[model samples]
Target: MNMAAVKLQTSVVSQAGKHTASVIFLHGSGDTGPGLRRWVYDVLGQNLAFENIRVIYPTAPARPYTPMRGAQSHVWFDRHKISQDCPEHLESIDSMCENLSAIVQEEIRAGIPKHRMLIGGFSMGGAMALHLVCRYHQDVAGIFALSSFLNKDSVVYQAVEDASQCPPLPELLQCHGTADELVFHRWGEETNSLLKKAGLNTSFHSIPDLNHQLCRQELELLRSWILKKLSL
Candidate 1:
């Protein structure tokens, strides 16, 4: 059990209604826990029926993104060169999966059922969400990946296959910006293809004219999907 107790900043919003589920948001690279307050308050908070669901935003530790970047930012794992078949990148995925598993476990201990939980993130955080949902053994309600890519090499494929044999796959919804320059649009296409090939139920959406960033339209779409999944 090589685990580290990482401190995470969290907030909860409860309304005068039956709570049906909880969503844990993992922020993208360079964003802090408090910085995501707007997303929680404006986007998800306003759109979702707060009476039935709650949201948690966790901040990652600040770590050097690269040996040369010098500047450190909040990230689940070290940011490395983007490659479809990079071994080092795959290793980073493993490390992040471990961290995400611990976070999810903590949430479960706090009374959130495994099937009532939704894990998601944006950009690099999106990558982590995809990795954890595929590797984690429990059944999650759904996974929301925004402006992200999957590490779809042979090693990752094997991991997904093995996990599927033992545990049920969770529903997956992926949203990508067609005009994203930071992570090429092709990455999203490839991720969808890989998941579909593996026989997982997945939905993919391409936001038109969007760059490597989130927009109102995309946020609304995510909100609708999450609510529908939770039946709230």
Candidate 2:
């Protein structure tokens, strides 16, 4: 968990001209950057076509996750089970946040303001995304978490509080299914409540009759949300 931050590989599709904005979407534990790019590309094409926006899907570092039975997977963090919590969770999250910070810095150095970039992810990736926004030194255009959990710490809470003092902490959108068998619903509630307590702008959507996977409704909402954020 203390490994130096490695530059994450990304599958990028961008406009040939100057990019008005950029988005980096992190995939779930077992998913690859290229795979997520296809999903995100199709979703955006269905509703959003801002030709100046650059969309990227970044690969996670390979780790032999215990839940995967020592099988290496591109995961943002290590956890034995979706809902299981442990002391090492903090370390895992910090490492991932550092890695994400590196990605955000790259965008900033490319003449894109951090506030003009969006970062988000699904499942474990979602958890990492949320954590990165909260823990990092700066904010972005926005962030969304799908089926993710919040970190447990006064330190993280303090960071969110401090970030909010700067005004306009990256907008937070948390969506989770009520019947999500893996991460469960309560964690989503906890995340929402935590952000609210820190005075950060955060919203939570509890999808009814949904499971571990994204449904059409969630997809539509995600598309709309991203479009709205980008337009800002």
True-structure lDDT of candidate 1? 0.72
Structure candidate 2, residue pairs in collision: none
RMSD in angstroms between candidate 1 and the native structure over all alpha carbons: 3.0
* TM-scores, each model vs. reference: 0.85, 0.85
Candidate 2 ranges beyond 4 A from true positions: 41-49, 151-155
lDDT of 1 by residue, 33-141 (tens): 5666566457545633456777777777776666337476677666455666554455555765766677678767867788988888888777777777766643888
Candidate 2: residue 193 Cα off by (Å): 1.2
Q: Score residue 111 of candidate 1 by CA lDDT.
A: 76
lDDT (tens digit, per residue) of candidate 2 on 52-100:
6787788988887878787988888877455434444566667777787
Q: Which runs of model 1 end up more than 4 angstroms from their true locations? A: 1-3, 39-49, 67-70, 90-92
